[model samples]
Target: MRIAATLRMALRALRRNKMRSMLTALGIIIGVGAVIAMVGIGNGAKSQVEAQIASLGQNVVLVFAGNWSSGGVRSGWGGAGTMTVDDALAISREVPGVINVSPEVRDRQQIQANGLNWNTQILGEGPDYLDIREWPLQDGAMFTDQDVRGTTKVCIVGKTIVTQLFPNEGPVGKSLRIRDIPFKVLGVLSPKGLSVMGSDQDDVVIIPYTSEMKRVSKRTNLSSISVQSSSPEFSDIVQRGISDLLRQRHRLGANRDDDFTIRGQQEIADAATATTRIMTVLLGAIASVSLIVGGIGIMNIMLVSVTERTREIGIRMAVGAHGRDILLQFLIEAITLSSLGGVIGIVLGVGSAKLLSAIAGWPTLVSVTSVVLAFLFSAAVGVFFGFYPARKASNLDPIDALRYE
Candidate 1:
């Protein structure tokens, strides 16, 4: 009976000051909403990054040139000119963990097809490039070993290049000119979206590495090499094997540093995941401050409520209501108010996240954990901040409260 009466009275009091109650709840609503939205966006970004990394395959390794010095001055951009075709072949022959190797030489050039032209990145690699990079052909066949050996004028175009250069016609068997050198299109690549670095992976043209080195780049050195290990679990073994092979081939005396760098997919994934996690935590912490401020707002309003209802408290005490009953009544009112705000905030937060995702084309993932956490924290804030005001109302003297005008 006491619980029922306390609830009835609390409801009546809340109804009597509807505007003030709503204003108090608004703070909590905004705070909880912000927290949920921020967390959802952060998780979505992390998942997107992981998905992009996974798309590159698991057992992949990249070998690139390390910094070199000429006359004691560092030479080449990104420490270029370390790894060579001979080094790649040596690693394939000597390294037990290496399954396949493809040396790459890259350049940016204008490509023209059917009178349409666009500038795109061109990569030259052997037939194993397709196997190592896992680039599946969309329409036509990949270049063969003979094509690479003879420096044949055959090319595979990426999806973006197909769209821009050969929009109206099929690219297969079509001839495209790369810097005025005509080549037969052998294949069109499947679409791969923009990478984390904002580069369009599908906006490229690929030809045999030997052809690019001799005819396009006119350079003997390679830019990098792609290596695939036999097993994903043995990435470290593969890396070490390649490093040792390169060291021996380069003939660096003991104590001299290596002239090449070997990187695996796992290392890139770990660094990216760690960075994303830190960003998510930081965003969550910043949003949580809003909840704290909302709690303070609830406390302030509860104090005002206690001051306004002092006479009512005195009457209840006179009529045989215990101090505990008064405390419970006010506490319940505060909890109900904050809890309702939390629910509304959750709805708003989810809607806002969906809207942003649709409009911006960004991914948004809402987890059950985030929702539960938001609700519980909002309710706890009510209890923590409501305690003082509830206690003050309960401890009031009946005589003094009654005498107050």
Candidate 2:
């Protein structure tokens, strides 16, 4: 009954100053709203980074040919003939963690199909290219090893190429002309949105490396080789093994510079994750300042409330109200004010996040965890800031409080 009476007194006091109560809660409202929105945006950015990393493929590493240097003139990496199909083959066989490897060369050509001409990237790759990149055909099957060994005039097309070259029908078994030479499309590659470099992933044609070397570019060395480890944890070990094998194969002494370069995609993923983590921390820190400011607002308004209700506090004490009763009353009032704000803030924050995504095309992920934290934080702010004011009211001398005008 005492607790019920205390609650009734709190509600009555709040009702007497409705406008002041709302204004006091406004600070908490803004703080909770800012926290939720900022965290949502941060989570969305992190998810985007993860998605882009996933697009690179699974447990992948890239090896490029050595840089060329000739008496005061030097060309950059992938500019030499140091990398070859034999190097890729050796790495796949010798490296303990290696699961797949494929050599590739690149060219550009006007590919004609269905009586239309479209200039696109031409990739010359071994049969293992599909396996190395974990790429599957959307329609037909991957080219056979025989197709690569025999340098057959068959190719696999990407989705963008399919859309451009064979819009009305399926790309399988269709003939695409590269450099005016006809080649049969064995399959269409499953769609991969974009490369890490922001280039269209599904805008190319892949043919046997032997075919490109023999019939097109006439290159004996590879432009690059792809290596895939059995697991992500084993990628570094596989990379080291490849480096050691290449060093031995290329006959480079310990004193000489490496004749090739090896890059792991894990490094890229780590960098992206680090960047998103920093952004999340920065945004959360900025929003936290509002919470502190709202706490101060609650304290200030509560102090003013204590001053205004001084005489009433004295009357209640004279009528046998205990100091704890008086303290509980003010504390409940403060908690009520902030709790109301927290509830409204949740609604506004979630709505704002959705609105931002819809109108600005920016991603925002509102999670239940963030919302619950915001609410709890608001309630905590009320207790912490309201305590001092409530204590002061409870301690006031009845004689002095009643003497005040």
Candidate 3:
């Protein structure tokens, strides 16, 4: 009951100076709101990066055929087809951590269906290519191993091809002609949006590598190979295993450089995530500075409040009130101010996050963890800043206080 009375008196004091109370809490409100909004944006960016990574493939590693060299004059990477179909098979069969290996030969060729012609990337892909790339079918079935061995004139296409050629119908079981040679469309791949390189991922046609060698590229070697591990944790092991195996297969001496290049998706993800994490921490740190400023504002206002209430303190002490009661009353007032600001800030922050997403086309995720931390910090600010003034009010010389103006 005594505590309740103290709270009532504290609230009444705030009510008597509504404008002053609100002004005092403005800094806290802004601080909490800014912190929440910034963190939301940071998380959103991180999520976008993760989604892009998943879209590319999970636990994927790419190996490009070596650069061409003549008399120590070397061309850029992927300039020569040094990696072969046998190399991909060896990695898949002999490597410990490798789960899937999809060898590929690439060409940019014109495709025609019903005389609707479109130029797209033509890939000579292994049977496990779809599995390795995590490219699902929107319709029909993937070409089989039997198709690859037979060098069947069969193909799978992506959404961009479908949109370009089969506008009103499905491309499955249809004929898409490449290089004046007709091939049956085995499937339509799911929409994959854009690749990390900003190219449309769905703008492609896939055929068996044997068929590509026989009919399209007339090349005996693979252009590249993508390897996938069972899990991300094993990617490094798989990469190392691949490197050692390839070096041996190519019969490279210790002094000679590797002909092929291997790149891991996990490496890309780690770099991107690390950059974003640093930015998030930096932004959140900047936002936290406002919270410190808010604490200072609270301290300043509380000191003024103590000075204004000195006469009241004197009267309460004269009327049998204990020092603890005076301290509790002031402390309760500061806490109420900060906590109320926090609540209002939460609403403001969430609203701002949604608005940013809608207006700016930037992703924003307002996590519960961020919200909880903000609220707790506000409470701490209240307690830390409110303590000194409340203590001074409690320890006042009541007779001197009563005699003052």
Note each model's CA RMSD in angstroms: 3.4, 3.0, 2.7
| Worst 10 contiguous positions by lDDT, candidate 2 | 1-10
Tell me the deviation in Å of residue 267 in model 2.
1.9
Off by over 4 Å in 2: 1-12, 66-74, 255-259, 315-329
Model 2 pairs whose backbones collide: none
Ten-residue stretch with the least lDDT total in model 1: 74-83
Q: What is the lDDT of candidate 2?
A: 0.87
Give the whole-model CA lDDT for all candidates, comma-separated: 0.87, 0.87, 0.88
Backbone clashes (count) for model 2: 0
lDDT digits (tens) for residues 127-159 of candidate 2:
878877778889898887899889999999999
- What are the per-residue Cα lDDT tens digits for candidate 3 across 287-391? 889988988888899899999878988998898778888889889888888887888887888889899999999999999999999999998899988999999
Output the TM-score of candidate 3: 0.89
Instruction: State every prediction's TM-score relative to the real structure.
Output: 0.84, 0.87, 0.89
